[model samples]
Target: MKVFYYLKHIGLALLPHSWFTRRQRKLEQKFADQQDYIQRRVDYYLKTAQPFTLAPEETTAIADYTRRGFTSYFYDLKEYLHYFPKQCRFAYYFGDETHIEPRHTLFKARPIAGDNERSVIFKLDKRRHFRFVEDTLSFAEKKPMAVFRGAVTQPHRIRFMETLFGHPLVDAGQSNPSETHPEWQQPFMSVEDQLQYKFLFALEGNDVASNLKWAMSSNSLVFTPKMVFETWFMEGTLQAGVHYVEVKDDFSDVEEKINYYLAHPEKAQQIIDNAHAYLAPYQNPDLEDLVCIKVLERYFSLSGQLEK
Candidate 1:
């Protein structure tokens, strides 16, 4: 899959300008029936006032790579920008952009709810963030214990592992080796291994949880506290006890939530179905392209760059 990702990048980078425009035109026609949804997405992601030009010094010219090393963020972000005008100006702060001030447009994988105006999120870190799995095992076949396996990046996660490390109903742990906290470390588990559990933790780390997308797409039920950050996946829209089972901030109810769902398999299945439905829009690549195009168009227009 990594090889495929790089190859796709190489192909896009080499592809001529006309090909991208035609692809967008093709997508527009192909999904013409879904204009309302496409516009809604574009508006949701971009809600800033129009006709405001950012200073040239504050903006960046469109290009292939923002810096020397090309990561997945560049790949995803450039996919939306390269086809646009070369003179187009924009500001971009890559990586976990927590709070972006006004007129300071930043493109990142995760944007907190309050910063949505200029955050301009796309699926930037595609290699790690966009993972989908096909689970053949039913909820009945999976273990009853809820499971979490990820890097202990946040202090909140450390507290989670400390509180429930020995709990039998939960099999949660920090999967990465940490010299500072060897006790919190456990051998890394693949997403496939996590599918074995009935409940999967979509705990937030530095940004939105990378596992949330793939975990919600799986057969297992997802457990998460309220999400403060969002991406193209629209994490903020996810409902507690509907799309996923909500966990308290203190995480005092992990076992209780897991146990309640275990006793009522039907209710768990409904939430799983709702999660799949919520993810339905993401299944269409054309829709994503259309939304990306509109987002950039609105961005440039609002930046008062249409005259260029």
Candidate 2:
């Protein structure tokens, strides 16, 4: 069965990574052009509204680099083609920055079937220059939503499932050790869930000094988002205590930032003010600011600031 399914979907499965193909190149060009267009539009807007002087090259670079990240999602979706009875739907979305490491599983599902529905969800974490996964959920037309309770993020977990079901692999979701194994009772939380924010916020506020220290220690691990909208400003590093706060060059840490700002409006304002000036020279300042602001708003809502 696995062999049969592999043979069936191999063609579409072999689509090249987004960076190498002609159509992607064309899409990349389109994105580049759009950035240029937006920058000019923004320049016009800013020029009329405020007295600002920006380097053309800086604006172009900012626009070009940021657009590349934002457009990749659109390009990926645009390039998606139906493999007949195997239409691919996003079950989880992750930017290329997120490494889709292999995991072993005990439950098996057909990959062809998965292409149609089973998917994982991840958001691009610009601050970390990677995608921090929110959650991995399974899809079935009739079902509400099912959690993929596996033991870990590994290929063996998926393979275990494949063997269990005797079917070719398609896709998977996150697993909970407590549910899967009796000896292990680890609490599982999806990044998509609201609790993650609360937890992180507590971690940050609970021991500001320690948290800052830890953040600094792990500064090198952070990756800024490739997009202009991200707030991961590449500002080097800050030493708050024994540990330093890993300063991002951009603002991709949208969620954390909103929370931080809400909690410490002064600091947040400082960031917003600085970003306004620092990113002024880069491309599409308005659009980039808009994205970051929107992300902040969403976080506000999630934090119960807005009524749904």
Best by TM-score: 1
List model 1 lDDT by residue over 63-92, tens digit each: 523654547766777777866888888877
Residue pairs clashing in model 1 are none
Tally clashing residue pairs in candidate 2. Answer: 53
TM-score of every candidate: 0.93, 0.20
lDDT of each: 0.80, 0.28
TM-score of 1: 0.93
